[model samples]
Target: MTARDEIPLRDADQVMRLSRMGSFHQSRLSFMRILLRRMRNENWQFDAPDWHVNENGVGRAVYTVHGPSRAYSLVAFAHDLPDEMRSDRVIATAWDTTFTLFDGIPTDDDIARLAQNVPLQEAGRISVRELTLSRANRSARLWDFVVANLSAGRQPDPESLKTVGYVMRTTAVYGSGKFGAADHGTIQDRPEFAAPFQAEMLTVYLIRCFVMDLLDHNAKCAGGKRAVKLSPKLRRALGIGNSTGLGMAPFLVNHPTLLHQWIAARETALARVRGIKTVTDGERDVMIHHAKSAHINAMNWHSQHPMQIAKVTELQSDMVMLCKEITRIGDAPYPWDRLYRWAAQNLTSEGLEQVVSILMEPYGDVVDDLADAMSIDESAHFYIDGTQAMGHVKSLIAKHFDWALKTDFGAGDEQARFWYVSAAKLEPRLGERDAEQGHELEQPLAIGRDVAALYRAITQDETVAHFLRKHPEHRHILRRVQMVEKFPYAEIRDNLLHAQMMPIDMLRCKLSFFGATHFDPRSDRWLRICMFQNAPFPDELYVPGNWVYPEPTGAI
Candidate 1:
């Protein structure tokens, strides 16, 4: 349907705001669901060929999945990391377990080769046969408690499972040629890996399986004949945990076209759903069921960050109000649209986004195809449009960067933060411009401020080529200005360098797109999240429907 025939997509200014982007919720178009749906449709097969861990949980395992054309194996090396050495920070040297997603079943030599490097992380180097290199630290209290309880011939408390959703939280999962692994370009053409981060997602999924298996192995080793396997419901609840920080924040800014496709796909999905004038009884039931499920999830969501705690409280209240108000659903014309409007008027941003997510649940046929459109040939947008006149560039900025122009970066507080790469781990870090020493070496992440500077330096009459020839430094932002003309969601409108800017906003926006849930922020800089929670393991791929959302009973 054309824009005139349906609700137009939300305005970029409104959608791209940090607050709204931060409030984003996973939908039918999320990458994780897309990957699982494909694998299930293809009837993939999974098996563990090797498990040699001992009572001390120090050994290796090989879990592999055979897809339509190829097989990928997660070769896991478990270690008995000392309590003093375990840390979630990227700079940490040792982990409880290390893994590499090998291109296929590895031979004894290949396993031996990886064991030497995988645990060393950044210091170690893997070969091109490896697709991903990752490491994880056990959730100490939960791991020990579960082992202790299971070793004594009993299940760990479900309440404890609810509190700590994962046995191990991945500190890092490196892919795409990082540390000598096979580049994404090598596998992007494979149907199973065509979607964004499919390899990485699969890596994490298989890792979850291994972690579960490891727990069982450890229990049997600790308590000989009495050890038992976890119930399917409990097993499904344990997802792989991820500790993400400022390092991920630059990805959205650096890959503007890709970011645009992601946001645009979700917006287009929302627009299509809002366009429906008639809602079938089945669609209505589905919406109500998912809303109720989401409410349960919100109630169970835990966070220590003050802002996140307040937002979750507001969301719990919003869900209560929504449940009561939805009784009037049949009275409204364009009920989904009307519900969205009501949410905007009555709910917090967090609540409003939850409404958007649940609205897309029943309309999968209308929105699922949009995931195909989420990947962009970002290289196509990398070239500078040198032929455009300076006046044209200025006009483009005026149209797309009005928020940047209004920002007063000259003020110390307004320009208080800068993004830089840490020397210790070579990861991105946000530094205070007033207290930190590296503002001069700031990464190009502060696009809004740089665009403002570019606006001031240009003259209307000159060509972009002419201006850049004299001032080479404006070249990067000039390309961004040109790219934004076609990809409106290319730039975050807020001043990222401002003291008030929250890197967590960027993290939440990206993670939600990956279909993560139960965000529990540890600080404003980094957060802990669960991925594939309540999702079917690869062996149970035949039935993954609605696994991303929790059941009303709070079981998988």
Candidate 2:
């Protein structure tokens, strides 16, 4: 039985709102949703193999997962290290441990071969079979406590989750042909894995379970006959921790079409929910219920980032007032639409958008319908449409991208910096246009200033093909202009060259929809996040899909 056959359409203006997008809450549209969906539908199975660790949880481990259509394994390499090696930054080479998500179940040879390559990361070359690659360091705060408690056959105190939530914090999860790994093109169409980041997600999902088993194994090794397997409930408490900084900021800008598709799908889902002329009384009740669950989740969301803290405050307050109206106007006309209006006025940018996100849950039939289209082949459309006329490009820039023009950019503050790729790890970094020296090697990601320049330059040409022939160097932005002709919200209008560029807003816009809670901004550049905070464990996969709304404690 195939689900998700319908596509929801959103209001373009509402979807394009910058602040609203930054405020987007997770919904059925999140990657975690798809991962859980596929896991249940396919009935994927996992098994533990050789868990060679001392009582201290040090050594190699291998676990394999059998999906509906294929087999892959997670090979975790653990090493003892001093405390100083625990940094989550990209430059740090030595970690407490390293892990690789391999393409298939490994033979003894394959495991030995991986032992030679996976740890070296960029330095040691890998073959095509290494599907999704990543590395993580243990959370010093929680790892020892978890192993210690489990060894004694006791659950770790729940309060430990408040400060540091996850066991293994992934530094980076690399996929799609990075570092000699096979691209998604290699096997994305296999019945089991078809979406963007699906392979990477599979790695993280299995790793979540592996963290539990790995810790359990270490406990057993320590306790000999006394080591206790983790209780099912406590195992569910573990989530895969990801320490992401500004590195993700580039993808949102570089893949403008994909970004537009994601936001558009989210908006379309929201609009579709609002457009439902008549839903069952049960359905209306479900919406009110989930809206309250989202509110509770928002209340527990702990983030010190002033902007995010302010948004959380608004979301909590708005939910209190909004839920009252939802109950009072039980049979009200245009309930969804009216709620949206109330939110737009009363809620913060993130809060209002978060409401739009949670509203999609009651109408899963609508959001799920749009899931297949969420994945995009960015490489397919990299080339500019030379056949397009300059007049068409001009009209596209003028009509769809006026936001890029309206900004007062290129001033001393506005143009204070340029975005460049860090040579050490090949990650994105921001440097001053004047204060920093390496502006010459800038990556072609700044869309606002360059698109404005393209708008001006196109006027001098008769045809876009002629213009491209004259200056093929600006082909990237030219392709983007053509893409935006159809995808209006494709380009974020913020000028990357400016000092005031809020990269956190860009990250928040993407991560929020991923169902991530607690946006801890370590700095404007990078931060920490917790996923599946109130989410259910894998055993609950066969339960109803609406579990995202229900608290783990069974409230709402």
Candidate 3:
């Protein structure tokens, strides 16, 4: 068969299930990879125009990247946060460092203004010239080890680096009109900001560079002439860690159109790769090479949480099976499709999703363009079609939300949890419906439960406009039902209020799109992940090809 007879996209019923969504791995289309690829292709230039930190690591530095049309700078401020004051929670007011991604190269006067407010975070204010605001704390376990060893002119153990993964972990990275920063609408027209989260991804990438530089400077000051800089390979292995919590879980539910575009882009890429009628020897070899690297990545992945530990264990076994199976498959026609079909039946969801990511590794020419289509003007889909008949609406509900229709929301387990905004921090929080006093103030995140209610409320054979006038409570869900008709992957096929529901599953799904790796869950509500791990720094962007997985020899 020809490529024109491409494999159809996977059904939303199969792909949108929370179990499968949570099992997703980063692919070539991940936002981080997309940003890096663009930077490399455009021949972007990076430099540190100023570094004024003292031996105490208390000062400000500026790192800038000159793109084809514009220059953006990361103005980072280092603080001497006491051990007692350090915290990863949003309620905390202090951090080891705070940064903002300035829209362009900022002048000395602009720096003076930023210095006054950036460190105060939420309590501070920024102008529209800023794109993002973020803060990170040093890792308690790995920070001292690296500092002591580097100060003594010795390299920290690679095993230790592998164990902890990063010197600092960002507690939060705020953007998109947050804290007076420029709204996404202002920057969406720019070519560099075309893709979703490109600005935030760029901010994190530069932060990685700043973290390495700070470590080197602090070590030199402590040991005088005896200190040494980190080797390039070891530095490359370190990534910027992030502590993500329940606050991120609502994104996928709230931004239906955007979520659909992201998932649709990925699903399209997978279908294109699976449609290949012939696999060349070179393509087959590249697949095997990355498969081995993926195996090593899985082996080195560590997590203390029981759920993640079990998933990682299964992933390790799946990689081994995949390596042996891919080699034996040989040069068969439609080899990728054949391997994917086999994996679906033999492997767990974690391994099965990894196979999907690996299949696209050899076909960048076919899939990379999908990155451009990932962003959406969600406002265009906001208008409701009030003229549609109730029968048509019922059919749309049946087609897209069958899982919700089947669920018994009346049961205690089905409606056990409620999502709320915490009064103190104004962050999204999950609470027990039965035991909590604030169930009366719950947010409208229970899409499944609401859809079920909408289904019951639709007792008349009339237009949505007429039906809604009599029962206005169903207006929100009716808009969602209509939206899902055009966007198949828009709604997650699960009951968000179910007692067994894991919010980490929602967090993992979003982070994977950001190209995060090493998902170490701290609890059912939050997790820690490493970003740009094994990825090239700005100076090393000239080196090309897939860098998501580590070399076998260098594997920890």
**What are the models' TM-scores?**
0.97, 0.92, 0.98
Clashing pairs in 2: 10-268, 23-350, 245-526, 414-498
Best model number under lDDT: 3
User: lDDT per residue, candidate 2, 1-556, as tens digits?
Assistant: 1123233465455565555556666778887777778788788777756676665667777878788767888888777778976678888767766777788888889889888877776666667988867787888768888878878877788767655667778888888888888877778677556655777777777667667777888777766676688776555555677888888988788778888878777777777777655556787777777777777666666677776677678778877876786676555556677677777777767667767776777776666867787777777767777777888888888876676777667568867888888887678888988888898888897777777778878755477789988878778888888887778768776567777667776787787656666677766777777665445556677866454443433443
Among all windows of 10 consecutive residues in model 1, the one with the lowest summed lDDT is 1-10
Tell me which residue pairs clash in candidate 3. none
Tell how far residue 301 is off in model 2, in angstroms: 1.6
Candidate 2: misplaced stretches above 4 Å?
Answer: 1-14, 223-229, 534-536, 545-556
What tens digits encode model 1's per-residue C-alpha lDDT throughout 299-322? 878888899999999999999888
Q: Report each candidate's C-alpha RMSD, comma-separated, in the order given.
A: 2.0, 2.9, 1.6
Q: Which prediction has more favorable lDDT, 1 or 3?
A: 3
